[model samples]
Target: AAWKAFLNVSQSIIAIAFGAWAYESLGGTHGTPLESNLVAFFGLAVAFFTTNMISVSIFFVIRNKNTFLSVLRQVVGPGGINIVYGLLASPIALIAAFLYDKLYVGGILLIILPIFLIRYSYLSKIQLQQSNQDLLKVLVKTIETRDPYTSGHSLRVSRLARFIALELGLSARRVEMIETAALLHDIGKIDSVYAEIIRKRDRLTDEEHRVIKTHAVKGAELLQSLTSLPEEVIKGVRHHHERYDGKGYPDGLAGKEIPISARIIMLCDSIDAMLSDRPYRAALSVDQVAEEIQRCAGSQFDPDIVAVVLRGETLEKAAAQIREASLPDVVGV
Candidate 1:
């Protein structure tokens, strides 16, 4: 992220410098104080505007979890940023043609292009957000169908995750993404080698355990194909199982290396899973589950996130709600 920011800053500086040079070459003598002042002001504005667009683009990319190209395309799509830019630039282009002729046309083009580019970026973000939600719904449905015992597990987890995110002061949009990711965190189970273990109300085989563990990787692969999701979201989906002590699967990312969203999902997922009965285990009481989570802080969970959850009144209510909505033994069987 820092590198991207640096590149944006550099590009803006270069553009402003080139614009100043071109203006001077086009008979605006820098020797005159008034001309110099105008050139400086224009260059500064261009730089400022360019940097502003870059910042917005970055934010859009993070918000949507989309590739840069996708973001650009959306912002420019139909009556969006592109149209706004075209409206602003068309007159400038016409004026340039009439005044200094084609020599100044390039300047007008540069000014107009960023408009379309930035608009496309913003639009792409909207598309990405919509796509993520749609994909999440599908994933959650698939997981729920596979395990009748956990029919509403994903939904409860999402609610719990969202509450925790809000408690941590995450933005509404971020909380939404975290919720979506939580809803689909177990999606990798679709390809699980332990499908029978999940179905049979008995102990899982060693091989079944191994297969169950592959869900994180599978879920990440599924999300990666969408192309509209952000890297952080993908990481969260992939590493939700990772322990803070670096004992987790796929890549054993520990502590801060684990994406914050993933950390949020991990705690919520565990809490929900523990509070709900599974074929192999009885449902733990809310107090027991909370104590377990607190005991494992800095080992299985992030301490800071655990702290937030502990203080969250909504979290306890969410857990109790999950218990109330518990599935019957027929669903588990």
Candidate 2:
């Protein structure tokens, strides 16, 4: 916390210095005409905002030991809302400063309400996004409670899917969509109808297995009821079971017919399943899991995505992370 505060203060100081240098260098004298000073004012604002963002971004990169682009994504917020807020606030701040210079305390008081309103609006939007995610997590937790054997399954899949999506060089928006879809992929199992099947220790009979297959479409329908989920997310949950060769399930979306998010989740879901111990089988080693994924490519999994997973250390890194944090130990261990 202290280090963050220090960085913030440093950022402010650097921005202020840059703004002052820009204002003076742009030739704004004490009695300059409003038209002439406008250029200098704009220059000062640009310098301040740019300097501030750069300083803060640098601090985040060093502090987190992450890449600049990743830090930039965090600072900009999803969809660049934070950047929009900063742009909106910049002009307001300049207007406030001008008013204060002209009318002293009265000018300051006049713009105070507007400043607060803008700040409040930005915060409200952020809070609303966070609340929505929390609601999704609560729903996931409910599903977890319904079947203890699959504890942390969704989270592990989500984490692995995120890593795979990143490895595939997907855009930030696509990554978020894939991660969210993976997290809710099994949400349909939350329904009481699947309680017995999910909790059953023995092998499922054909009838019970058929019932379980409905979960993909069921999850999509349940999420569709929310009305706010994106179409990609709905398709991901609906088609995750679909095989690449079109032999899999609920609609049998073949090849690229399945959404990219669904394809990523399908592979990740299977990976986690192999890594986790079930009543019927022990968890497979990482090498064994990789071999299975390779064996299934172009049939059960997307060949392209499987290639990405096998490239470099992506699969190993993803598996290591999930085993260490996102998933429970193998049942006996």
Candidate 3:
């Protein structure tokens, strides 16, 4: 991440410098030498600062490969980069045209700089997005390595949550947030408490349960440190275990007080856990698991979400769909 940030900043500076050099060389014919130099310098500085700030912010904000690419495409489209470049070059372009009597050259530069700036910003964003995705994949892999039974769990949870979000008619951006949050929801389990609990498995003592419950809080803390993750993601990690009633842990937040992203993940995670066999017990049949979920609705689970899950063909069908959607994404791991 740090390397990518450095590269992004460096590339932006270079692009700005190159653009200013071009403008100074071609547009200074009728302007006083000092006036032309100052205009060029100011324009370059503004371009550099603006692009650099945006690049760094984007690196932190976007972690998905495809989604980040889409956002970059939109920002670099005809109007996006052009807008930034125009803003940066307008003052210099104007001074050269009117005050410096370099109307023809300044006018030409004003027309050209917008396209250059837009292209530079777009390319930089693409690079940063790719780097961010690579970093996240590494982090997820590390998490999976530590929990063999739950290998690919994060990816599965992310896919299932995304499917539910889509079915619930959420906006594309909102769905994406849920998906990303699911991917990192259990990341805090990388801490020692989680390791100790997992090792103990079936024989957990009361002290162990207390330690395990801290994972939600720890996960939230870990995610909060990452300024790049969306606020919804942090909230989901902090409250995914929270029940619809006021009985859940960490903050004991209830019902609507729990974030939608967390609720979506809670359902998905529970379904996965029930469907998958663990060392302690055999995997439950789909129908039986569904019955359990149905029984728990409005108590352990959200009634509305349970209704949505059950409205589908059957528990077996829902389980099949989750497995189908997630397996390919996770198989290699």
Candidate 4:
């Protein structure tokens, strides 16, 4: 979020300069401190907020994770909410400006107070998001330590899932949850009980396979209390192994019976698995992977999601990007 912070700082400077200019135009330093400062404060706040909106738009545009309309909605939704408070406080600013000749340092304090609050709160929010991301990275590193060959699996799944979700026309909020679930879908495998099963090079026995299937449930439970994630997120982590047909474990949820987030994870998880090598097998050919997904649709996978990756214009591009960027999964620790 260095970019975000930089934009905020730059916007603040521009706003302050604009405010000072506005104050000078109204009446120079000869006027009372309160009125002049209030005018400056109002000018700065509006300008800062306006420019901040622009920066947010540009920031997301450059990132280009979603369509222009999607990014616009994502940026404008939060900004519109924040702007309400600014509008409400406008009257106070007007009053302060009117009483400029009458007041002193108190008005200046009032003027700076809102700016300080806005900046502090915005920075704090950014820091919190960064911390969560760092935490996810740590978890990914832990997974890598367990299976070096599978390094970057979770991140790839997350990236692919997010793009697919956005392509499906889901709202930004739903897409975010899907991305989070994708990143943590394999969390249950981190349990010590699964160590031997996970590292085994040979075929797993029926009991070992059964034990392995429990990882989905275990992962969801492990994360349930740790974060205030929605039920969709937890369910997605738990039911990612579920099939479109009724054959999946933990829950036999079929078709629409499965949460959309879980359905997304299932498809994404499979794509990553096909692209990634395993201890037992090398990565499949791209053509083979595509054929398998198409063949498995309506049975092993969601036909809709499969169609998106295989046939939809938007998702096809995203899937291609992931293929080009994804790291190959090598065998051996």
Which candidate number has the best TM-score? 2
What is the C-alpha local distance difference test score of each model?
A: 0.72, 0.82, 0.72, 0.76
Stretches of candidate 1 above 4 Å error? 1-135, 192-194, 327-333
lDDT of 3 by residue, 1-333 (tens): 997778776867766776566556655343356554655555555555456445643663354322333344333433455346656655654555453354566666765677689989999997987797668767877877765777777877887787677556565667878988888888887886577577655778898888888888898898888898789989998899998887988888889899999998888888888887678887788888889999989987888888877866435654675566446544563
Candidate 3: give its CA RMSD in angstroms.
11.7
**In what order do the candidates fall by TM-score, top score first?**
2, 4, 3, 1
My TM-score estimates for the predictions, one after another, are 0.58, 0.77, 0.61, 0.69
lDDT of 3 at 32: 58
Candidate whose lDDT is highest: 2
Clashing pairs in 3: none
The clash number for model 1 is: 11
Model 4 regions more than 4 Å off:
1-66, 76-108, 311-333
Q: In candidate 4, how many Å is residue 15 off?
A: 14
Per-model RMSD to reference = 12.1, 4.6, 11.7, 6.5
**Any runs in candidate 3 off by more than 4 Å, and if so which?**
1-120, 313-318, 321-333
Worst 10 residues of 1 by lDDT: 70-79
